[model samples]
Target chain A: MGDEKTQVHFGILGCAEIASKVCRAINLSPNSILRAISSRSIEKAKQFAIKNSLSESVKVYGSYEEVLDDPFVDAVYVPLPTSLHLKWAVLAAEKKKHVLLEKPTALDVGELDRILDACESNGVQFMDGSMWYHHPRTARMKEFISDPTLFGQVKTIYSSSSFFPPPQFFETNIRTKADLDAFGALGDAGWYCIGAILWAMNYKMPTTVTALPATIRNSDGVIMSTTVAFHWEQEGTTATFYCSFLSHETMDVLVLGSKGSFHVEDLIIPYEESSASFNFTSGASFADLHIGWNMKEQEVQVHNELPQEALMVKEFSRLVKGIKDSSIRPDTKWREVSRTSQVVLDALKLSVDSGFKRVYI
Target chain B: MGDEKTQVHFGILGCAEIASKVCRAINLSPNSILRAISSRSIEKAKQFAIKNSLSESVKVYGSYEEVLDDPFVDAVYVPLPTSLHLKWAVLAAEKKKHVLLEKPTALDVGELDRILDACESNGVQFMDGSMWYHHPRTARMKEFISDPTLFGQVKTIYSSSSFFPPPQFFETNIRTKADLDAFGALGDAGWYCIGAILWAMNYKMPTTVTALPATIRNSDGVIMSTTVAFHWEQEGTTATFYCSFLSHETMDVLVLGSKGSFHVEDLIIPYEESSASFNFTSGASFADLHIGWNMKEQEVQVHNELPQEALMVKEFSRLVKGIKDSSIRPDTKWREVSRTSQVVLDALKLSVDSGFKRVYI
Candidate 1:
């Protein structure tokens, strides 16, 4: 939020369960306000708002188009299914509304590129809702991994995000429907895993990706569980990630470097709202043998004034405000990082289709 | 150890560095004794005993054959390179000495079967030197993973054992020599990862093994680092493991189940000598929502009365004593598990050789 001319008012373009979390995040963010909610029916949108205890002033709209048409809404939070992202996100940008698109930003990078192009031409900020990246703990982890003296060169990364959905959700969830999300768990749970891997590698794209075998799928041909390995051939860095909707919930990212290693159990969602933590170990100076045991692990704890999602909302709002208040153009860094993650996801999906073959990125 | 008649005497073959650890294990194991030590040079063997602070009563032999031929040596611990395993292990069994063999147990299943066969024929106990298996922490972790209500069916496992060896080891160590360990990191570090995966799956053989791409190799074409995936088709369980000598030391075994999850960071070697821990989570019943926030992780700690390697020695000594004092046959269970692990490792090595193709078990 700048002077009175620039506050990011958000219109949530669906009453999806995830939208509930974002609405709270918008409320918590100092510069953002949840101004409206939308659904296929106005009654359902009103019920969702009431269930989440939204402000009395928040508007309820029967159609996503109506939310986009509202001039008072400066930004649109697109929490629609993957198939709807390209159309709605592009439309929001064309309408001069900043877009906070939900993840698996589009069915593939082609659609994501089109949306990014729309945002670029329209001078609207574009960012996928990758909330965990905004966590303070992530920044602290980056500092440790980037230290050449302490960590040396990064060699490998292993990330995993899996959760066994309720048995009934498998039959009803849009994520499992081919026409809706299409990529299934690779698009849903795997998106976070891929993002973490790419982020740990300093956004360097992998040369190739190979899907691990025994990918489980539902009758609808939606992937339920799978693993993909990424190789940075020139850098001699490798990464592997596991994603699933059929396994117990476990989120982790482990970065192994020549001189040190870092690990975090709750990478996607912190176990607590107040703080998060990571473990790092830089080899002891006297141990030229590269033994980790000689070094005492530094357990770093990062306290957050607001939840990660709120931080993400605040960051997005700051960008949107910068565009509105100054002659500053929209930041392309968010889109660039999102595109890299999507590219890896597309290759992994291709690898699964090619019988777990190695597909170059 | 056996009042007077049942002490399990031991003869060490080839004064390998790892033998120092096992020699200490033998000393600490109440039922076992280090009766003899062997090296190509008798003076070298004497020097090793003095360096390791061995008792003056222990004998030092100039050759491995002489130690095997010692009638009073009831058992022999073979810490030779993998290329020498099949020959020395069989010869020791033929001499009626129980064989506690260091792992990669053999280069392939055929060689392992030969060693197992020799042990069977000569009525001698056979157990790989997978010291961590005998740790009390392992038993405690097993109970949590096996609980049908708490853990449900194990859906996936991810295990990794990697260490950044000193640069000189690449040129000087037997592990990196093609004619010695041949498989390199796949044999030295990967063996523990594979064993842990198989152990998590209750020793069930995988239907197929697939090598992940970007397997790093040294000039001699030995794998410096690599990841392999295993599929237990009928059991609907999948596992992946990464092993390396070119990265920071990280030993982890993560088991994801339908209802719960378990993680142990130091699976191969505990950071401390006296105790270790594992993290387990059984999700809250009401929140079947697949969000993990409600489940409080239970950190279970296990203290050891003796070091894990010592416990392994005690277990092997107990089995050897059973064969000597009673009408007990050698336990086939140990051979069965070791054989299964070797079969998977063989398939993985074959997969790596076949241009990362899938190799059926």
Candidate 2:
């Protein structure tokens, strides 16, 4: 992913580790190009550019303001800390730059609403950095679960997104700092769980959100791990998700329906870059004598030419290009997805903070 | 499996649907034989024997008392409903017949205790018919999870057991009758979920059992579906399970540890009879650039000469033979396993009955 023909110029407002991945995605996308990168220190920005082997033509800036002020930049990918997202994302939108904000979009729905309002008023397209939605495998899974005969109504869903971080992370990582990333693992890893569940439910909010009593927190009162459950009364569907920084690496989601079910072990990142697969079964039942299943779970494989992150950038740039070239407005789908996920995340937070009470949505 | 050389003669009380499967298993095991089959009516017993293609040498008893009175019968397989377990199991034990009981072992632990105590006092062996426990795959999985470095400490576990039964099943099946199988799906299907979770935790009782508010019941006040949670305060481990007769067939168990994880889509009954496999990954981490996994989950296959039910019969017969010939005491392991499962099952029922309150174990 060296450099692609540029249609939309992109600027990154932070040097977070995730920013490096997005920077490459910008360069790889067919209609987007990396224009600039900024950190608090110009020296640090230069080091980050060197570390990621950025092209010489890509500008390096000392502060985020410089990137927003650059007239050529059409979009900004904000990978800043959670506490800084409201300020930086609104500023980018006000500067008339489309925004790809990292998740959990903001501290709470109030901050998310302010950011969304700014993007709407400024007429700038907004999307979160949940790259998995752009993976072709995701679309394939949705197709399977959406089939009336094959999948029927969803009965239950269970998702897990976790990783065991090194001991040093507790001492220095911004996620463990209340002021920097107060939501901690619930914001970092739990974002994917919420997004996956919401995606399965077609972004419909849950009737209730309840945190399990096993929430673990750091000394700074920042969550390190938690489990939450969601109930959709109308659909009679329930979902439970566990996100943690203390468990081994896992990005798994299982959805069971009346007639069919599917499981994906690597939902966030495919085990391979070029292809991914999930186990699916339809009309399964006990074989005669109850000795075995009537059907085995078939592994349905899906291939993609580009990685999910690149597809995400390509999709975002396509929306930005539409508004710039024609009179078309921004697509509201992505913002709505982010907003629903944020609202649920906020409810889970409230449930945990209130001694594991069940919070109605 | 034609009749094997007979060592431990088995007389089945109640020609329930599951009895046919176990009937075949008895004939398949090397050291076991089906000596007698019984039902309340001799005609029904004759019908069951004919339908299952039982050997002419197997006797058709008019009543369960007739099977127990036969001095040649060394063991009895009881597939009677939960309401009849206490009366029949204790009677079989008192008759000096080893007991192979179908599970949700009894209506409650109190009844299960009486059955176990009768077996102890009569010096007769006891085992519940949970066939999966005897599968070689179960032993292999136990090895993987026991490894200190490869699997590390168990962090969380999730189990699901569900199937969408025919509508007629809800109307006429014994499971739907209040007095026949009071626990309904909770006793029949949820039994496997509880057994699997406890098996993974080495049969330790959970600190607390909490049933979610999603319990669905039939008109007879029998639980048809439910979701429950278990927390092990000492190990900092949490487990959740969903069991129902209202979803597609699934017997899934997922165990996540500090350094490894595994998922088995078919835990109760394997997808195949001759061999089964589970997806396992140990010491897995993100690949460079967080684009993919460093290692893919490996599918570990385990093969068995006999099916799981046959293995279960063989194991139970072996223990019975040791006690009958060598004057050795009956093995306590099987009874202990059944006791723990019944204890947890009772807790789940109590939680559901008490308005989804958390029950301390």
Candidate 3:
């Protein structure tokens, strides 16, 4: 942080496991600092602070409202359960605190819209906690995909986001409990897949969303796994993604263009924090008699000075700073991006509910 | 060949561009030798022999029947269009000559069954020309997918087979003609996709086949590109594939298992003639806080002494040798594989025909 007086002070609402990661990101960001930690039980919040080795100058609060009420808290990072997002995120915005909400931003677009409305009405910045978007490699991939002659028109896309957790995860994880996180893997793991697909499409809403008939559900009616497809009728582009809680870990995205394609294996999280790479090939064709390819995939490597989460925090804090120091309005680009992803997620769920029918947006 | 008299003799039935490659493969296989070449016209057949630099002893036939009638021709490689497969394949088998047929085995399983029945009744071995199946890398991939502990159960699979042909291909290629290839890209490119998916599933037929609505077609209503899905209801597995003639070249197959996953970018054709590799990750899990993966993908490389096409010829000839020397019956495994792929391909076409509805197997 350049100056304590000018840094965007962050207060974490609820001591969720993800909050610990963000706390470090806030500290790593040059324009942000973690100032408060909150939980329903003050003792638990203090324990989390100690576990994370927070600075002695940081404050601990018994309730999220206390952090919201703190004048020094310039923004609130809400990593609460999906069910609690609409409540706290809206309240944070109502209290004039910039909100960085965790994904599956809300239960559905209805709830997501309400949260966005609150942020817009209160003149506060809003961004979902999809940190992979901030990675330097993602930008590099965008450049290649956007290239006209090298990449050409979009053709088809595929993405997979999955992880096989331990056996006990199905029994007690908050993600498996219906009321705690109703969308389950679709909300947790699928959020990233949908986000990545939409990002590659430049956040354009798909014409139709169809859930494949292979979705698996837990006893509590939470999704354990799913396969879905999106089609852009106008562009003749199609995308499919598989998200699961019961498969080997994977975060892969493959984008095929008319003249080129790219594949990223670790899209949601880099295998390494310092650098990441994706393989791409442009104008590839078969060699004589089709015995071999004329070209091979070229790896594009990108080095990042900080982790993607830190970059996310830095970007959010910069927006907050612009609002505070220059009387600039909050950026709506992030909110729009989150809104598009949420809408697509909602439609996919609708398709699943309606017997895998193709639901038009 | 170790013993010239013991080697299987191959007679190619056409001078299609692909026939030149198989001609070379026949010569490359130690257990097989190119004994004759044929075309509709004697001049074209003579030119093909000279262009391929065939041995001076190899016979040149003005018509396919002459090659089939030749007593020295032990097997015939049919590289004719789909419309001509049943006529020539049946005649070849009726003449006691083994058959090596090009893919999209036939226009449909009905036509395929007729050709296969002739082979069975006449005691002749029959196989489809899918060279990738003979690649050493394919066997290595199968080993991983079959390992119970290392790969576990298959969760989901995806494949893409595509190529951007020159503009003239759209106007004059046999694949674009309705009566010549009928199935177009679905038959030409989609055959490999169907075969690859079924191979990963041990040749089991899917319960349902559904065509995605994003299929593109040429002006003649021949499929230019299409996407399809397969559901194995009993095993709770799903697979999707994209096949096209209007996109950049891509031969990708990704299979995700419960404990492992593998991605082969050059599944249909290797990037090199001598060696190929695929990336796989087994027992993958997220590291603490999900900042990174516990393990990264490992590259497994397989080297081959001869090209995959030559290996295909060798395998086919080995079966022919078994029958010739030891009174062995034809291997039905290859026929069964081709039949299953044809059945699925037919169902996918049915789905497309029925307005992208799900067709039950």
List the DockQ of the predictions in order.
Answer: 0.43, 0.73, 0.80
Q: What's the lDDT for residue B126 in model 2?
A: 98
**Taking the tens digit of each residue's C-alpha lDDT, what string does model 2 give over B1-361?**
4335448999999989999999999989989999999999999999999999999999999999999999989999999988999999999999999999999899999999999999999999999999999999999999999998989998889889999989999988888899999898889989999999999999999998887777788888999888788888788788888888999999999999998999998989899999999989988888878889889999999999999999999999999989988999999999999999999999999998998777889
**Tens digits of lDDT, candidate 1, B216-254:** 888888888897777777867778788988877778898
Pick by DockQ: 2 or 3, better one: 3
Off by over 4 Å in 1: A1-5, A284-292, B1-4, B284-292
Return model 3's CA RMSD, one decimal.
1.0
lDDT of 3 by residue, B190-255 (tens): 999999999999998998888888888877888999988888888878898899998989999999
Backbone clashes, each candidate:
0, 0, 0
Please report, in order, the local distance difference test score of every candidate based on alpha carbons.
0.86, 0.92, 0.93
Would you give me the overall lDDT of model 2? 0.92
The collision pairs in model 3 are: none
Per-residue accuracy of model 2 over A239-282 as CA lDDT, tens digit each: 88888999899999999999999999999999999899999999
Two-way lDDT contest, 1 vs 2, winner: 2
**Model 1 steric clash pairs:** none
Name the lDDT of candidate 3: 0.93
Order of candidate numbers by DockQ, starting with the best: 3, 2, 1
**Residue pairs in steric clash, candidate 2?**
none
Say which candidate scores most in lDDT.
3
